[model samples]
Target: MEPQKINKGDRNKIYFLVIVIAALIGTNAYLFFKDRKQSERFVTVSAEKDKLRLEVEKIEVELDKVNALNLDLNDKLVEEQKLARVKIEELKASLEKAQITQVELDKANKQINELKTFVKSYNEQIIQLQKDNLFLKNSRDSLQNTLKNISNKASNLENENSSLNAKVKTAAVLKLQSAEIIAFRTKSSGKKVEVTRSSTAEKLSVRFTVIPNEIAEKGHHNIYLRVFDPAGNLLADEGNRFEADGQEMQYSHSIFINYNNDNSTYVIDWANPKPFIKGIYTVILYADGNTMGKAQVELR
Candidate 1:
């Protein structure tokens, strides 16, 4: 075996060829593993980017919806404000109408109060007039009886002169009962009297009778009435006449009575339109220039 020994140069060449082959195989395996790892990393990064883009798009859509809702809410607020203003105007108008109605109601109440006062005054005047009418009818019956007795005695004395002279003396001494006032009231015709509220005028009816004695004369006798106001001032007559207490007064009313039967009633209606003060009034009656009777009346 020693005889065929190999040369050193050939052995070196063989070992160098083996090293080259090993280096080539190691380079090919490293290149394949590095490429595969790079490809997988790229795929993972692409998927992550897609996921982030989708999430951003979803957030933008939600923001748009929120903006639309905000706009709708703003429009609703504007409409509500307008409606509030209109309601306030209507309330103001209603309040003004109510105030006007209240004023009208107050005025009507005042007018009603005034009318009530006027009606009360009218009723009082009617009651007083009725009481005076009953008093004048009784006084006229007594005066007629006195005149009949005197006429019978005078007829018997017509034939004898001395008896006539004696009869005249008897007549002078005999005192006959004076005329009595019967009733006094206001009247329109024969009916009971009524006064109109606006006219302030009243019609007075006075009735009386004269009672004759044994020597009573049968003729017309004069009767007069003097009216006094609340202040004791004499009432003026509508007719122009200037006289007082006997000389002929500026205002005087008179009546005449004729004796007939045992009794007779005389009625005189006097219409007066004078304004009377509210107080007590006096009426004085005179027959044959002498005071016969008096009456007092209140005029409120």
Candidate 2:
């Protein structure tokens, strides 16, 4: 049997096949290793991102605690705390992206560490602030104790002066039920009707009801009324001054009513000098040295 030798063309074809097979094998090896490296890089980056996110969340929790402490910190510290929280939020958002680079992860790690440092510093400051607040609170408590002793002595003195105090306090107490100011005018037929127009406003009718009080002394009592314009100026006539609890004050009008242990109604009319301005007017009632009631009227 004669062995047939391979032709040059066939040899070339076999070499070409071998070369193609070798190239494919090399390409497959390269692809496999490359995929493996990519997977490893992905896992590493994911781990870093997750770790940073967790760190950010921890920082967020600490920041919330700091804010919830309600410490009276300086404005600069407040701003710093706000900035730290914002940074943590930003880092979390960035880490949640679909794709992140190693360099970016590195930067995030650095930023997170810096934030941790900032939080530590902030915590130290908070501790110091707490100490200082405790000192201040202790000082305040000590002062309060001293003031309480002084107040006890003063209370003893006040007991010695109880009679005059009772007189002043009793004279200043008032139990008013209702107070109102009505604008009205007299018709030509000598009839009075309610009017809202300032031009027709001729009288400010002040009406009030005083309820009975067992604590208040029962006798003839004079009620004083002070009317004020919108500009907070007292509206009163000349020589309308009287002393209420040793304080001299000018009043718009005074009414004398026999208040006998029961509800008493009184009305005092104030003559308007000119047309009342279209604005809000305030009427305050005073008896003794204390304000009893207040009413407001709008003229249009």
Error of 2 at 108 (Å): 1.2
lDDT of model 2, residue 85: 76
On the 0 to 100 scale, the lDDT of residue 83 in model 2 is 89
Task: Give the lDDT of residue 104 in candidate 2.
Answer: 84
Model 1 C-alpha lDDT per residue in residues 23-92, reported as the tens digit of each score: 9899888888888887775565445434433433343343344345433234544454355335334433
Clash tally, candidates in order: 18, 0
**Each prediction's whole-model lDDT (CA):** 0.51, 0.85
Cα deviation in Å at residue 224, candidate 2? 40
Which numbered prediction scores highest in TM-score against the true structure? 2
Candidate 1 has what TM-score? 0.32
**RMSD list, candidates in order:** 38.5, 22.6
The digit string of per-residue lDDT tens for model 2 on 193-289 reads 9888777788889888876677676677778888887678888888999876568889988887677767768788888665688888888888766
lDDT of 1: 0.51
